[model samples]
Target: MGIPQVSETVERLWNGWELRMVMLLSLYLQIFLILFGRRRKYTAGFWIGKLVWLAYLSADWVATFSLGILAQKIGDSNRGSIPAFWAPVLLVHLGGPDTITAYSMEDNELWLRHQLVLVSQVVVAFYAFTRSWWGKDPLLFVAIPIFVAGIIKYGERNWVLRSASSEQYRNSVYSEMNELDSKFDKFSNSEFFEMTDERLVREVDLNGIITEATFLHEADLFFQMYRVLYADLVLGDSIHLATHIILRKKSAMQAFELIEVEMGFMYDVLYTKLAKVRKSRVIFRASIFLCFVSALLAFSLGISKNNHAYSTAEITISYLLLYGAIVIEIYSVVLLLFSDWAMLWLTGKRKPLFDSVYRTICSSGFLSFLQHDKRWESTMAQHNLISFQRSKAKLTSISLKKLLGKSNIQSSKVVGADLKKFIFQHLLDKRTRYNLRMRSHDPGSNDLHEILSERGDEVFGREESLENFVWSVKFPDFNESLLAWHIATDICYHDDVRINGGNAKIIHQNTETSIELSNYMVYLLVDYPFLLPRGIGKERYSQTCSAVDDHAELLDRIISVQPFSWYESAITFDIEKSTRKVSALWAGVKLAKSLQALGTQDGWGNERKWKIISEVWVEMLTYAASHCGWKEHAQTLTRGGELLSHVCLLMAHLGLSEQCLTTSRLD
Candidate 1:
């Protein structure tokens, strides 16, 4: 059969309209990417994440498909007469979006595939350029340098991907350890000054002037502590001292700012080229700018000379390409300048002009918006399984109203508790006591749970039986313990008013923390099973669900008498006696009653009672956070992140995880 041919009308349309449409489409995709690329970090909504994911994948595909079409056009005699200038423009588009390099950690590991794509695309772009070359056209001169810049930018994305791969990142950390070890050896024998009990009672004096210098100093100190994250190193006593010094010196807001900057650096290292190009950022920036300028100048000269036969549409498209490249470059430069990386670099220089500029930018509302905490991490999405189940049970009008989207909601409710500050304060207090006790006597091979329990005992005046009951250090199954505690917390929370009617303020605060932490732990249990301890969270969840279902008739009666009173009635039915099997809810109710009875029998004050409960909750939270794998934590970053993951990292940095033991062994 003879090869098929298109009609002249179709050919003309393809040449004149379709090609420009694709180019315009590619440009629009780039614009979308620039605007929405960082939205995933700030949002945990299903649609927003899906949209960003779509844009992320589609941007590369559209650019590549358009380049293929351009290549096909280069071979057609009729379309061959059309300006091939768009070929290099497509190359620039194919360099991919700047706002994201890798969507997730797994993407970083696929750098080899991207490298192959880079080679193939460069060859295809070059083929299109050469086939359409008509001997020294001024427009071709403009395209050449812009193409080089595009290649460099694209190559940079892949280089960053390789550098950030876990293996490569660990290697980079290991590379620095020889110097670290030498310094460590030199300091190992130096006797450290121990603070006396009297000196410890007096808070560390922090009267230094709070300025950019002070903030930078604290950031540098924290960054040193954070570097252990990359190296898989234990946060030793040096890290503990650094954290204490910084926390003592800085206010909570200032301390959180340093943390934000540290997280920003981490985000860049994992998902951007910040670490890969830090040293040569200025040089790379200048090179890209100069290339764009050269392209702009060459294109302008070509327009002035009118050396080639080009349609007005083609000429306009060329102009858009040149201007778009320059404008995007300028935008990227602005982002780089206002970034935490730039701030860190400027702080290191200690120049007055740089400091003034930094201060001015920091004071601006726009810069604040750019560097806002939300940009780095979203407020964690709360997902309590029991709450979720209650909502699903359709038991209450309020939950039904929320389900039907009729709660007069105007914005996403800040439903989750701000536990970061609380966790930090608790760790700080615990570490102080831990250091004191460690100095006084040997801790031996005691794990994190033991240490926390020992320190907790000291704080609460040694309630041995109570401590053992609340947090059994030798408990073999974490999942079961979590279920028991979670249920107990929920029961106690609902029964708070009945238990402590007079002290509203203390009861309310403790109840809030207990409920929030309880829900968060259950969220991990049901939604993120891998992050929980070694048992099957799903199987346990299924068993609980089956038990709840089996008691449907009884639950209906309870709900009829008092809706949302499942916990109240659940306490009466002993799980051990029930035919359906031991229910988590029943176990929880027993625990709650026992705890309340203990409080009454011991004549414990409201403060002491709540303190004990909160301490136990913190211990459970720490246990889960410390036990969850780092890979599991990293996996959550692309999904607007999770509080569990943040807590995990925080626990590791605080030297409260068994991973720290592994790291110590490495040393």
Candidate 2:
């Protein structure tokens, strides 16, 4: 009746419960690494490699647990041992196959080492099965599911390596639109501009005055105005839509397509003048491949067997793979939702580029007539024509509080004092203000307005005809300088402050907007002097904003050749249409500035500092462009330069010493 003594090895493992303790420890480690290790910030690939190997080592404990479970049920020691060894065998098969366990692209290099560990585990599992005094059992059927899942995971990892590593995918699509066959070459007549003409209105940024000016030139004012309003409306929609797409649940393919579309639009915008698009396709393919592999792995796991035990290893592995699939799918879904429909919508809002040919319009500009309050009211009325005419208009107006949410500040006040102050402080110079007031400020000007209204009545006659004429009327004498000033204030005060304050936290949000247009144009024209504008028709303009990114450089070069210098006097005159040309020129200049800074500074300091400085400038410029009425001036230059100084100091502390010492002039 004496109990059979356990073997010496089993006895040793039982000393303070070493075997169970090791298994438990292994289980904890695996769970911890899988859940949290991947998210550890700034961890090198080496640690990630170690974690992957840890999962392999831990799988042995899972095998031992399986064996123990089998042993308890079978009663016979020989039958029990077979199931025990099977766990390790399955673990060996499943262990070395993941692209994201380390969450770094470089982690793929460890796959070779994974092969080595995998081989060793296979050997151990084989020995455990054969050398041990264990009998076979039907429960060993569990290994079948595990083996299939392992194969799937391995294949997924391989797919990720192939797709993500491809160089062709990194280029964007917006850069290719300019290459479309130049079918409308007839519109190229207005493309050439004599840059040296002093009479031509120029969009200039002189110190603080930059923020005050919106119209680069009076002749170009309508184009800028059109660009702003169109971009505002369309980009707003895109932002709303992109946010929806990213946050919503969707299939991997759907999400991939959406994100791809966004990238394509960016390419078009950046590369309108170029013949070829660059690397976006490659990156897109890589992204799609990753999601595809993830989907396959999830499919394999979903069909796998369910386990009853809470602590069972099968349940754990199944859950891991299932959740991983969800993450991948969801990530892709979010990406797709954020496509560049917003950018396209905004860019084309000014006017359909195709229709522009018939309309004889190539670009948009500020409307000087809009400076008159009555004229702006007319424009607003025109904008609301459909809404105002709708049967639900009165009801909607009454419920505006509900639809738009409660107004924080009274609408009138928000646009009154703050707006007037902004306009006077930034937009009006003493000379222009004096002249404008003297010519237009008479109280009796309203009588002149009455007289003009009466005179117009004599000409057009009927009330219906007058209303129709009013609706179809275009603004006269567009003021590019004043509008640019408003835009500058808008960017600096409204958008920048809100964004930095975390009220408007959006990723890839900065890339789509009228503000983005202003910053991009300014950077192109002012920063890159040697480049010239190549005449791209309206269709090309639309395409450029929507094309792939690889053509960005080509677009930059083509636009740079146009004369790009900012002169204050240019805004006062009936200058030739050239804001698009200048904007393109500045974009190159801005990019070149970053390059120059990056080139001279050696070590990481140069690259890092220059990049930070460039980003700071961009942020400032974008902010200024969004909120203020400034049309043509690059107003963010002064504030951005000031911020750059502070950023340089900060970078020095973070190992950017040389950049802080470098004394480059903003002027």
Candidate 3:
């Protein structure tokens, strides 16, 4: 074929199917998002988040563009009736899925921008409907209910966005707690309601009811109380007292499980519509469902009369659209029926049919995978500063590890049972000592919050043998302190690896826990500094890495740092130009030498050495948790929840935070 003929044929085909193709694409994106969007919270790999994000953005653009096309078709009076009906369908797509709304906390803040888009699209859709053969066509009446359903769904999207906005979320704290209070009243009459604050302190077994159901109830309750902490508000006495006592009786794993459920609920609120219009969600869902079915049936009947006017492909595509809409409706209903909100709603309701169906579905293996116990991937991201810098120094255009982000120094470890037990036991032991002091001297919680705020000085104060090593802990700033300890920890860990040579399994495993925490903390500094208290951590990290990234001997065996300076660019942190006689990395080396000297002193061995380091690392973890703004913690929940956030919540449950009603800021 000649070029002009080929172009004409391509143009003709596109004109015939442009609207149809976009409609199908819009539906496909809707399906893609609803099924996989929630996976961001549980699934591993960077690609899933990126794919969901792409689909999330595409779904809106395609739907909006379709609305514009429909308006133009109506104004031209070409396929006006069918195009008018489709405008509402585009609105349904614009509403998006129940699985996600805002991809990040930043997306939630742009809710006003979404509001503007919603207004403009609604206007265009309305214009399309009016410009269509309204009076002459019976299709107008059939389109009305569909438009109502579409508007409700789209409006609900904006409502959730607005509700999740930072300004509104902070205001939602008390209202959530108030709702929780009502649920507590319902539970007050049952055996399931046994874990009152005072009761939890004395109870041996942790409360009553079936396992999963009990967790949902507790999740609802805790999210209500601790969401105040999430909003950075002061907790009332009643909220903290109950949480402290309940956490005291439970094992570390149970405490973490409770927090996971709490985070899961928070995720639902910020990223889904379940937490919005809770009292009326059922009514709204039913209304939209009925309207949709009505429109489908109306179209099915009305289309037969106009079958002669439309082409076979157009007819086929229209049915495909209808089927896709039905599938989406059914899928959303399934999600709703099995959702945490559904579980919460079913908690005290003894309606036999709903109750039996709910339990059977939850217990069935066929659908059981949908009901997971944990809400996140449960892996702590690990990055060794010395090792990562070494690899980064050698990075080149053809480096496979850089291309794939497959650096061994940067990875994640599944937070195992041993680690959980150690962490819980450590806190349990701390609380026990505090209780002992209360019994003998009554030091009050004022000192406890002060200690909670310490990065490592608190650990130093409690151990006289660690006094000489206090310089590493009590640095001039938190960022430099983190860098110094990170390097020192890496050195001691590697030296032990060389010395131990696969000895006792138990002792080696203990060493692994401390190394993991050390690596994980440094990982946070490099990748997720927002989760920590405000610091020049990234700057110090860059300075440290830039200093030693190319040092062959140090890395073969590798490290540096400085304070944040507005006047000085990070690139200017050249090692030779530093004001200090001893550079940051060299200071860490000196500290490591000091620790190595003490490793065998006073009958101390590698075992005791790592134990002190392990304990101090935990203190640093808690310090980061307590000092970080709650808003930062909440923001991490949508991305599978952070270990820091979990520890932070655990500390609050144990009454370790300044936000705890029993603790006063001594400062």
Instruction: Please give the TM-score that candidate 3 achieves against the real structure.
Output: 0.87
lDDT for position 158 in model 3: 90
Q: Model 2, 194: alpha-carbon shift in Å?
A: 22
> Candidate 1 lDDT, tens digit per residue, 1-667?
2334457667668757887787888887777766666565545666566677887788788889888887777645665344556777777776665667888889999999999999999898888788677433335666677777878888888888988887787777664544434333322211222443333223222123136555554555455555555456654443444345446544444555565555555666777654423657677777877987887787777777874556678778777777887887787777777776677666656667777887888889999877665444535334554445554566444555455443322222242334556666766665555442234223454445565333123434466557546443233566666676776665555555443542435464556676666666776676577877787566766676666565546434432323344345453654445664434655655666676666666567545666677766776776676666666666666666666666555544455555442222211
Off by over 4 Å in 3: 75-83, 134-138, 175-212, 276-279, 350-358, 397-409, 433-445, 501-507, 558-583, 662-667
Put down candidate 3 lDDT per residue, 66-163, tens digits, no spaces: 88887777535355335356788888889888888888878889888988988898888888888766535545666687788888888989988998
Give Cα distance to truth, residue 259, candidate 2, Å.
Answer: 11
Residue 487's lDDT within candidate 3 is: 75
- Superior by TM-score: candidate 1 or candidate 2: 1
Range of the 10 consecutive residues with the lowest summed lDDT in candidate 1: 184-193
lDDT of 2 by residue, 1-667 (tens): 2344456656655642443444444445544544433222211123443564566456545544544443343324422222332334234223322212323434433555555645554454444544333444323433444434443444444433333321311221112211211221212212212122221222111112121121121112222112222222111111121122221233323322232232222222221111112254334435544544554454344434323222244344434443543344344333322222222222333445533431332122222221122101100000111111222324535554444432211111011232222222221121122121123333343232222122112222332322422211122211121123222322232333343453333422222222332333333322321121222223333222332132334333222333333232432121223334322222223333333333345453333433332233333332222323211111111111111121211111111121111111111
- Residue 20 miss distance in model 2 (angstroms): 4.5
**TM-score of every candidate:** 0.82, 0.26, 0.87
Q: Tell me how candidate 3 scores on lDDT.
A: 0.71
Worst 10 residues of 3 by lDDT: 558-567
Candidate 3: Cα lDDT at 334: 78
Question: What's the candidate order when arranged by decreasing TM-score?
Answer: 3, 1, 2
Q: After superposition, how far is residue 640 of candidate 3 from its true place, in Å?
A: 0.8
Best model per lDDT? 3
